[model samples]
Target: MMSKENYEYAKTLYEKWGIDVEEVLGKLRNIPISIHCWQGDDIGGFEVNRQELSGGIDVTGNYPGKATTPEELRSDLEKALSLIPGQHRVNLHAIYAETDGEVVDRDEIEPKHFANWVNWAKEQGLGLDFNPTLFSHEKAEDGLTLSHPNKDIRDFWIRHTIASRKIAEYMGKELGSPTLTNVWIPDGYKDIPSDRLTPRKRLKESLDEVFSVEIDEKYNVDAVESKLFGIGSEAYVVGSHEFYMGYALKNNKLCLLDSGHYHPTEVISNKISSMLLYSDQLALHVSRPVRWDSDHVVILDDELREIGLEIVRNDAIDKVRIGLDFFDASINRVAAWTIGTRNMIKALLYAMLTPNEYLKQLQEEGNFTERLALMEELKTYPFGAIWDHYCDEMGVPVRENWLDEVKEYEETVLSKRK
Candidate 1:
């Protein structure tokens, strides 16, 4: 009763500013964030002959109840999704494929391996996204796969990526929505490389071959993710932002921008508009980086709001694919997913509740003082009430109360896991 009363009062406050609170919530319900499956398992994929987590990727801490199997992972995901409002998609790596204990190598992986996942998504009424895991295998032991000097190594990754696309297509066909198949390779040098051009050349040619076999865009859209540097590739990363940006522009592929992949000073929020101008669509792997690419769980910080503002204000929510890409083993995995995903949704909701057109008009008129003042003042508005109402309306626990549910889950389902 109190929550309902508060929402009514808050709606009146925003109504004075010409912000339709109910309309905003309606739009918010349709925005689907692709929640990452890796968060539940610390990226320890279900490969029969799983190698140690290599590449620049690392998941610190070992909280109890990490999902050890595909069923467990999906169950964890289901719990996380129920707490988060709105429908969402699940992001998967090729490593997560189930092969029935068969030793299916990356290149040999087929759509049948992911049939279970497609079936599961159909039952959940959820969409699926895919990535071809290019690290943590014998082929990528040297921190090189697609850009390896050896043609055979490059060809193997190319075949794996092509197969991944076919699997993504199958997922899209089964689920009735386009599956975003993003390819991110961990190929780079820790020490300064004398010759950077050759590896990049190989990567380009390899990508050319991968995309040469066309699948219907209706079923799947391809994206290439870039990294600035990594644990091994600190000195040189073959798939730098410039490399993939140029490649994506020329080849009609989506350029996936991971928030944690850039220099500490760079923000993915600032790049969304520029990327959209050149390409019809782009994708994002939203992660938090403390100092390096640490992949901490996301929080509703300044940059996050700016990212939401950019997407909402520009009317590019559909054009920019949003997916979470952080995993922390230090805390309960379901709680981590719940926190990060809820924060993302909150950021979007905050953006939508703002009087964006009025602010833009202020900027256009060169009213800097009013613009700054209004922006800062708007921050203190009754945003929490609006958020609480949203959660209630969506059949989710509002605010910090969700934490209690997470604690219950930890005590019951998670604690029982080995």
Candidate 2:
């Protein structure tokens, strides 16, 4: 941990750059990152008679200690949340609703099915967010759901999404916070389709029906997600970025920007500003896209830093909802959550500690030379000392100490899961 004297010295250094070190630390600590629950089980929910994930999504590894039940998943999530720095939220897919070993179809899911989760969140003092599971089912076997040509399939998926919104609202009302239930359909073809426009039309219509019964925005905030392509939907995806961007704009819904949903070269940091301008609110599904939407664990890299900077620099913290979305079963599941969530917090701290006022002024004055030079110089400032101090203040382990807690957890808790 950084010493008190060193922290004060670092504070003075950031003060020179017009940054308030204590204010920055408190703000970063207060901002909550919604930690996705699927990371605990690699998206394999506790559904009985579950089939292998078929519709475009895929998990890469067979690491041990994957949570197989709702209890285990919640336990793992609790362990992960322990090492993270802030009081965070939990994100859930509808497929994760506790069915009590009953065969509940996606379309039949109710708020009662997720009552345990709501209570758990309340007990933990965490907020809840949601997603409708539109993939990996018999109806989705053809690699389509909401946009499927068969009206029956489309209606089924639409009903499921409507029900999901209700469940999200119930959770939110019960927990005294709004739940953001995002809709992302894996509805497209592996090969190039001759009539791509028809499926997109079907998707738009289905979304209209799904949002027709407007739940109170304070209880349930609906967001739409789009993807470039998935494994089976490589040739064309019905819910393209353009499609949902247009939908979100027209319907007055939040647009979800998953960091991994775009091409490798496209970073969401570049899109956050635009998304915030048109939508009443913005939702982010943070992940790392390797060559494609690989769903890799997030790290404290340049793109992550830029994402944090974008949100903070634009003064959109309250307008933007932050969430982590990655499933890495190659390593310890609990550790994966802890590492990714912590890195995300780290990035936000880096952005919070930045002196954006001077940079923005330089740009506005058309002083490109000083702006460029100062940008590079600010990269080497004492960010680590501030981060270390922040972590210490938050009561999370500072430096490499959190990793040891995770390792010890694996040895004591995760290793015996098998």
Candidate 3:
């Protein structure tokens, strides 16, 4: 654990760089990272006779402690949240609906299906974000959902997206915070298609219908996510970044940029400034992709740090909505949550501690050598000590102590799930 005197000394070190450590910690506390619920259950939703992870989605391992029921999933989430500092939100997919033994099709789902989730989030004092599950269904087996050539199939997805928005609206109203309804359809072709324009055209039309019913902005805000490619949709994706960017701009909706949704060489940290130039608000699905869109656990890597810098230095924290989106069943599920969540918090703090003004002055004055030198010098600052203090203040175990708690949780709660 970090001692108060040591934290004060580290604070004074940062103070020399003209950074207010205490103020940054206060700001960090308010920025909530919406943790995905799918991570707790390995994305195996509770829908009856659920289709195999299709439409480019695949869960690699059969982890023994995977949450089998709603009770187990929420319980696991509680354990993860306990270890993580800051009041975070929960992100849910449409397939995670609780139907009370009644079969609820994707299109027929309502806010009632998620009443229990809303109540639980309320109990935790957390907000809820939502996504429409467009894959893992017979309707989407052909590697298309909203962009299907068949009008019936496309209409089915449209109805489903509309229903998801309504459900999100209900959550926002009940919780008194606007729920972000993000739409990400797995609509594309496995092989190169001759008629690419037609699919995008159909997708635009379907999205128009899905967003036609104007839900109150206070209750629900809409966002469209784009993708580079998926396992099945390798050749062409109907909802490409360009397609969604144009749609989001023209329709006055928030644009979502998943870090792992683009080419591995491309980093979303650079795109944040460009997106904010046009859109007032943007949503981010932060995940680490090792090579492809393989939602790996997030860490305090270069891109994650750059993303934090982009948001903090530009003062776009309020404009951007941060959410986690990755599932790794190869390890303890709750620990995966804790590891990723803490790293995210760490990245933000690292960025917050940077002396943005001095760095900008160096760049503006064309002192490139010193700018580079100072940048490297800033890396060695005692940000870890500050982070430990933040964890202590939030009542979470500092450093590796959280891991022991997770191991204990695995023994008590998760081990009994099976």
Candidate 4:
């Protein structure tokens, strides 16, 4: 959290840099924010026992191993919305049920019930973020078998893609807003020296079909490509291979980049530039580091933190929609989310204050050291210290204390996990 005096000092520095704090703040104001929700063992569940939470098993059994009834889930969502400041909206990812090892159809759940939940949220001034996988939760052969050139599997994917688009359209009409559709296909191949060509063609065909239907004059479909390793004996294969973004670009779709999904060694700016070159809408999933796991922890400054924001600023891409795609089954769920959100917001503000012309000049001069110094200076600015600065200046609630509350909550959750 930034002290009021420190914030004033930082504002002075911004003025010194010939940067219009008001103009930069105005641009920052335009970004619309949302979050992803699920009601399952993966993310939308309670963490009572450490073993169950860490072992990927559901012990709390809070929501019957499925999403709670629409009404019940919406209650939790309303609570979440209350915690956020201003007219903050959420993108609810519907939970699908698997009965006797088989996927259940969306029709099994009453449409009226779902619509009622959407209406309730809308009445409370919240938005929806719909996930397509909710409708295509079929349990087919594992990736090892699906990797084979099987027409049945290929057709199944096509049908799933089409069905997902239809569901999004229906939800959009019901919610009376453009539905936020997030597509993360968990299909992949396992073995090495396998025929990647066939799977690639099938995947591309499915994506093309989705693009043809999902996007239009009203709704915007964002394709979130994740980088995952093998699932079992077979290595998972979707868009992990090289040139996957190029394929996505060719299809005329936007790319949602999960920060933790990439290999740690990959250059963030280069990836952002590539996505921009293809005219793809960039969506970010910010998370913390966990060895070989998408642990979705709170952002810490000691780690590779500054570089993440630097890439975003240097790229000068402000239209990017940032989602706090956090998953914390542990006890301090709200605290973890608050801390992560605060850190990310602070980082973004720091990036916004960066001089675009100075960055260009540094690039032209080929002085990497000077460019890094400027970034470091910006990071230390007190106005960039706490996101509450903007809220305070804007006459919103002073929220710097949320960070402290989050830190304490995280400590409690970790102690219980241990």
Clashes of each: 0, 0, 0, 6
Please identify which of the two predictions, 2 or 4, would achieve the higher TM-score against the true structure. Answer: 2
Rank the models by TM-score, top first: 1, 3, 2, 4
TM-score of each: 0.99, 0.98, 0.99, 0.75
Candidate with best lDDT? 1
TM-score of 3: 0.99
- Cα lDDT tens digits for candidate 3, 1-418: 5788878888999999888888999999999999999998878888976778888886666667888898888988998999988998999999999888887799999999999999999998999999999988989888889988899999899999999999999999999999999999888888898988998998999999999998999999999999999998899999999999999999999999999999889999999999999989999999999889889899889999999999988889999999999989888888889899989989889999999888999899999999999889889887888989999999999989998888887787777765
Off by over 4 Å in 3: none
TM-score, prediction 2 = 0.98
The residue-by-residue lDDT of candidate 2 on 1-418, one tens digit each, is 5688878888899898888888887777679899999999988887887878877788889888888888888988998888788899999998887887899999899999999999999999999999999878999898889888899988899999999999999999999999999998888888888998888888888999999988988899989999999998889999999999999999899899999999888989999998877777899999998888888999988999999999999999898999988988889888889889988988888888878888999999999999999989889887888878877887778887888987887788777887
User: Candidate 4's residue-wise lDDT over 214-300, tens digit each?
Assistant: 345365455545565534323546556353566656665556666656666653445665566556466665655355435455565
> All candidates' lDDT scores?
0.94, 0.89, 0.91, 0.52
Q: Write the per-residue lDDT of candidate 1 for residues 332-357, one digit (tens) a residue.
A: 99999999999999999999988999
Candidate 2 ranges beyond 4 A from true positions:
none
Q: Rank the candidates by lDDT, best first.
A: 1, 3, 2, 4
lDDT at 320, model 1? 88
| Model 3: per-residue Cα lDDT at residue 193 | 86
Cand. 2 Cα-lDDT: 0.89
N/CA/C clash count, model 3: 0
